[model samples]
Target: MIACNFSFHYTSFKCEKNFGVFLAVITIDLTSISVTSAVISMAGKVMKKESLSIEGKQGEQVSLLIQNQIKKLLSLFENEPIQIKAVGVSVPGICYSKTGLVWAPNIPGWDNYPLLQDISYLLRGKNIRIKIDNNRTCCILGEHWQGAAKETKNAVYLAVGSGIGAGILIDGKILHGFNDAVGAIGWFAVDRTYKDAYSEKGCLESLASGKGIITRVKESLNIIDDYSGYFKDIKIQNLVIGDVFDAYKQKDPIAQKIIRESVELWGITAANIISAFNPEILIFGGGVFGPGIFFIDEIKSEAKKWAQPLSIDKVKFSPSQLGNNAGLFGAGHLALGRF
Candidate 1:
């Protein structure tokens, strides 16, 4: 069911008769969804754009999908004058951009995987630069390059998705700490008392993320002796975050309690980001934000209770304008090697 989000994924790219020589670059957002596309930043045009399902594919299998996209991209311009200057990739978790090693926990068998090496083998004789970076880094890059954080020297892309992460920018440059493990804010301890649930993912992520919300909701569901609320029609096994948000909308008791906690935690996390970075703005995006978008104001209100007073007043929190394509666009920006 994964569909191409890029609009240019149709028909062969027509060669321009007199558009002048254009240096081309392509980028792929390779997670569960394979979003790959070629963008000509110079000409403000795109070519042979596409995306496909990379679901359940990990390690070498995932790299193969990327290789095939590169091959097809080359075939599109077969005998044409343009050459792919670079191919940028967006990967999950930690990625050593120089070493090409990735640690995508969501994708099975990809812990410390040599993704760049695998993709490089496929590029062979083609002289093209491949830039690979973490998804969090790419998210901030995309927002800074084209979204709400555009032109801001210091900003944070606080992504509240299935899991929580942040992409930090300081002085117009991404703050990739030593070993590139900088923005792993999931481990931030917001709770003083320890809970068994926080042992696995971390306090914030275990209690606030979409998966976290579902976990708490499910736990509550299991504890009730006999209850038939908004999720009465849904099987506990089939429950999802959307259902929880739906129940929240209906003011379901359990859903309200769970979401209220999540919102407060999100606000606390946002405050931490603002206090630490004192960024010009904080942009929020990711899967959970679909319904969570409506709670931005509420999150901000909660943030006021914990955030640095001066910093909170100076900072603005907004939803990501780039939406799902932030990583894709960020990868494209990476292809240009601007930073």
Candidate 2:
């Protein structure tokens, strides 16, 4: 019993005896927190959509959720007579299109999971085609298709959430490196002081990501014996990234210090990206950007300090207008390319 939240107009569409002639597509943005799916018309309109929370669920369990969403989306069109033509899935991590194997470290038991195979089996005997891609790739595609970066030839989407990653577009195409592992910018070295902690998550992400910020605050709290600030009343274990930003607004010294360092790291990361790609625009997105959007000016100023002089001036910085919908809309755009 899935609730169908539809915001589509199909009055112009005529339904005859052969209602199956009506064509539509499906798009899904599969992330660590939730799974969202939408029915997209050929004209790129989202007809109907549904989202399910899947936190703490494993890979196999998520597969079931995906199945449920698809079935529910398809059932909604029975009255409308629209036939589902294709499906495009935006995955959280590296998605190898050829093999349909997804390596999502965020999802337990998702490493090297046969996602395409699973979906194919689900849609067996149906003529519908499926395309799976990395979420970062879909982020830029979503932006290029309908969001901030429309018609832009070269652009980059810096997604700073619990972790950090990028989606690079060069000459109007998504850059997929060997093994399709491009845009893994979390491992970038933005900090000069190397630490044993930075080995797995990378220096930039360890310091700048939401998890990184929360962890840094907690670690600092543990070491500092006497510090009274916004976080003083809140237990250290209960601290989250949002608390840091809230405290920053209150002008808490500890929060200011932590966020200031993160700003520097984010700027360094942006500078490095601009210097390397020389994109037309660099869009910042992810969970952090919900409040993180406020720091765009600071990041740009920081980027100007280190980015190539020629490229820095050319690149315009923006917060993601589409937000989480970027991946969903981008997945729809990618499906449109399939034909």
Candidate 3:
């Protein structure tokens, strides 16, 4: 069996087995409102897992809740030590695992936090070791570990979730910039029109993040809610990208327009990336990608119109094969330095 945890700075995974029974792969996602945890056990080559999600307030309080959740997970396996080998973590921002320093955005009070030290302290003298990396890098590694890029040595993983980021792997190596911010593609400005409003920085995320999508929709329709569909039947605040996709599938004009605009922006951004990286494949993962994938072909078509023709032709675009498990999987891989 395998279990993993993700937080502001670290991601940890544990694998256990008892003769004929192996633990299943477990995945957890820690966001502002929700903290999801899972446990999986394996029998033979088949795997079975159970997962739970808890919604609560965001901010510092949420972090504490996550810590508690981790403690609970550890308690469950406290009596068994041989079943757990190592732990891995994936953070949202720049992470220097060697030093255990993490600088994250969404989670306040996490800047330059000594996450690995804290986790290690929490575990006391346990025989478990922890591994950590930036979420984007983890995403890329995760994809390579068990996702879309497994067969390709060179590929890029784009995470379009609450915020935008990328994980680049060239020649089978994850690129780490001087400050470990190599994949911080959210700040990349692709449109000059938003320069002034966005403070002269036109990060692709500013125009394409989940929040960006909602903001754009609001500005275009004067709607305050996130939903867009049969107006009276669906509330905007309750509308997520999935709901938007369903609306688009049902031929909702507003959903169609919003999706078209978002797709164009993504296409332009992807083209720029392809021109710069020229990877063998581009894997799209994260929460937004679930619905954004509906526009994959369209995005590629539009990317070709803007990107270097040769680069676009060289790269293939696809959805994440790991789905939500990319980070956890990458966490394990990072801890083991397997790839």
Which candidate gets the maximum lDDT versus the true structure? 2
TM-score of 3: 0.80
Scanning candidate 3 in windows of ten residues, the lowest lDDT window is 40-49
**For candidate 2, lDDT tens digit of each residue in 187-237?**
998766899988877788888999899998888888878888788899878
Output the worst ten-in-a-row residue range by lDDT, candidate 2: 1-10
Looking at model 1, how many pairs of residues clash? 0
How far in Å is the alpha carbon of 168 misplaced in model 1? 0.6
lDDT of each: 0.78, 0.83, 0.67
Q: How many residue pairs clash in each candidate?
A: 0, 0, 16
Model 1: which ten-residue window has the lowest total lDDT?
A: 1-10
Ranking by lDDT: 2, 1, 3
Q: In terms of lDDT, which candidate is stronger, 1 or 2?
A: 2
| Candidate 1 ranges beyond 4 A from true positions | 1-19, 32-48, 79-81
lDDT of 1 by residue, 1-339 (tens): 000111112222234332565567677886644545555443335565787877767678877777788788877776676766667788878886446678887777888888777767777677776678878888888888788888789989887777789999888878877677788888889999998877767899888887888888988988898877898789888787889999999999999999998899999999999999899999999888888999999999999999999999988888999898888778766766666
TM-score-based ranking: 2, 1, 3
